[model samples]
Target chain A: MSQADDLIHQPLRLKIMAALAAEKGAPLDFPRLKAITQATDGNLGSHLTTLEKAGYVAIEKDFVGKRPRTRAALTPLGRKAFRDHVAYLRAVVEAAEAL
Target chain B: MMSVSEHEARGALAEIEAVTRRGQTLKGYRYAGPILMVWGVIWFLGYLGMARLSPALWGWMWLALDGVGFAATLLLAAKAPAAAGGAAGQAMRTSLGMAAGVAFVLAIVAVFPKHDLLPYLALPGLFVGFIYTVLGIYLAPRYAWIGVTLFVATLAGYYAWPAHLAEWLAVVGGGGLFLSGVWLRSA
Candidate 1:
C-alpha cells in the first residue's frame, strides 16, 4: 500500500487538490477555489502557499482588465501524489472491510 | 509517514468527491453559458420577427437566425481551452447533438405541417425546456429549474395570451434564457 501524503492529508488542502485535479490541467482562479473549498481568504492563502512551497501546485498572478487575478493549478508531481493518496485511502477502506 | 484510520480515509474520499463534483459543475456552467445566451438571442429575435412580420417572412427569418446560432455555438466550442483533452471530440459531440436537435425539430415540422403559428412557437420552447431539464438532471440542479420555468412560461403564454403569444414568448422565453445564461456564468 502507498503511504499517506502528509501535505495533502489536511482536509482543506485535500479539497484544494481534488478541485485542481478535477480541472484536468486547467487553472482555477483563487476565488473559485475558495468557493469550492469553503475556506476563508487568509486560511486558503496560507494553505496554497504551503502547497506551492512543496512544488505540488503552481500559482499564477496576473491582471485581468486592471483587476488582479490569482489562479492555482496542480503540478505534475501534485497530480501523481493526489492519485497515490487516493489509492492509499481506498486501500485503507478495503483492508478494513476485509478484516 | 502518517497513518489514518479507515473512517478518516473514507471521510477524505468523500470530501474529494464533493469538491470534484463542484468543480465539474462550475466547468459545465462556464461552458454552457455562452451557448445558452446565443440561443436566447436567437429565440428573442425569431419570436419578435414572428410577432411583427408577415407569416410568409417568418420561416426565412427563423432559418437565418438558427443558422447563425449554430455557427456561433460551434465557433465558441471550438475555441474553448483544449487542456482538458479530447476537445475535438467534445466539439464533434456538440455538433452532433445540435444536428440531432435540428433534425428532431424538422421531423416535428414534417409531421405537423398545418399547425397554428402560436402552437408552433410554443413547440420549440417546450422542446428546449425539456432538453434543459434533462441536462440539469445530469449536470446541475439549476438547469432543471430554468427548464421548468421555461416550460411553464411557454404553456402560460400559449393558454392565457393567445393573441400576444408570440410577443410573450419573445420577452419571457427569450429573456428568461438570456438571464439564466448570465446567472450560470457567475457560477
Candidate 2:
C-alpha cells in the first residue's frame, strides 16, 4: 500500500518541496520561498530547519551587501520523497475512485 | 493530511500542481524582458542597414549585433539570483545549449559565400523560434505561442519574400521577441 511521506505530508511543507523540486538544482532565496509558500517567517524557518535536519533540503546563509540572504534547495532524497508522496496520493485517489 | 479520502487526495494533488505551475512561471523570466527588447532594437537596426549598406557591411553589422545580444544574454543569466533546478531547469539548460550549437553551425554555414543559400540566412531566426517553442512547451505554454508566432512568420518570410527574408526576420522575429518579453512580464 502506498503511504504519504510523514516528513513531507504537511500542507506547507509539501508546497515547499513542490516548489523546490520544480527548480531541481537551483536554489530559491528565503523571501521567494516564503512568498511561494505563504508561510510566516518563524514558521517557515522552523520547517526549514526540520527539513534541513532530515537531509531533505540544503540551506545556505551568506551576507549579500551587508544583508543576510538565505537560500534553500531540495536534496535528491527530498525530491524522490516528494515524488513518492504525490504518487501515493494519486494512488489513493485512484483506489477510491475505483471503489 | 494523511488520510486519503477522494476529496483530500484531490486537494493534495491540486495543491502540489499549483506550486509546481507557479514555480514554472514565477522563476524569474522578468529579467529576460529587457534583454529581448534590446536584441529586438538591434535587429531592427540591422534591417535598416540591409537596405542602406553594402551586403558585406550589413553582414558584419548583423554579426556584431548577434554577438552583443548573445553576450548580454549570458551576462543577464549569470546575474539572475534564482536558478531553476529540477526537470524544467534541466530542460531549459539543454534547450539553450542546443540552440547555441545550432547557432554556431548556422553561423559557420552563413560565412560560406552562396547567394543561393541566402534564403537560409534567416535560419538563426528559425533556430530561435525552435528554442522558444521547446522552452514554451516544457516550461511555460504561453511562451510556446511566441514560438509558434515566430516560426510561422519566419516560414512566411522565407516563402513570400526570399529576397528580403533577412529583413522580414528582423522585423517579424525581432518584433516577436520584443513582444514576447512584454507578454511574459505581464504573465
Error of 2 at A54 (Å): 26
Q: What are the per-residue Cα lDDT tens digits for candidate 2 across B1-187?
A: 3566788779989998998777656554555565567667776777667756877686678678767766776665565544443333443454377457556755776687676655555666677678778877987676678778888888898888988876787778778778877865553
lDDT of 1 by residue, A1-99 (tens): 998999999999999999999888889999899988889999999999999999999999999999999999999999999999999999999999999
In angstroms, the error of model 2 at B65 is 1.5
TM-score of each: 0.87, 0.56
Computed on C-alpha atoms, the DockQ of candidate 1 is 0.78
Clashing pairs in 1: none
lDDT of 2 at A7: 82
The DockQ assigned to candidate 2 is 0.35
Off by over 4 Å in 2: A1-99, B6-14, B82-102, B105-113
**Model 1 per-residue lDDT at B21:** 80
